[model samples]
Target: MGITDDAKDALSATGEKISRAVDDAREKVSDKVDEAQADAKVKHAEAERDATKAKNDYKEELRDHN
Candidate 1:
């Protein structure tokens, strides 16, 4: 015995749906990663700015003491 044309069609349709779902999930994950990367960059810049400000304040204090 052999499989019928209807069964093959149904299998093909299922495969297409699964592929689409996988692609959608992949896009969602990529978007989240991009957002996280942007957030990290902002945080790193803020930290650098804070550190520089603190260093300048310390240097000013040393000058005042001298």
Candidate 2:
């Protein structure tokens, strides 16, 4: 089945948040992307965790709204 409007919005917002985090991580690491690859990886992993939480929260919200 297709996702609900609310679910889509939630997912999009979560993605945007992750993208921003990735950008911030890149900026913080600075100058040499290769040297800072490890930090970038960690930041992406944390963002993934955050995205998972966001999805769960959205699922609960959908349940409540329904």
Computed on alpha carbons, the lDDT of every model, listed in order, comes to 0.97, 0.90
Best by TM-score: 1
Model 2, runs deviating above 4 Å? 1-35
Give per-residue CA lDDT, model 1, range 1-66, as digits (tens): 256888998899999999999999999999999999999999999999999999999999999999
Query: Model 2 misses residue 60 by how many Å?
Result: 0.6
Model 1: lowest-lDDT 10 consecutive positions: 1-10
C-alpha TM-score for every candidate:
0.75, 0.43
Error of 1 at 3 (Å): 8.8
Say which candidate scores most in lDDT.
1
What is the TM-score (0 to 1) of candidate 1? Answer: 0.75
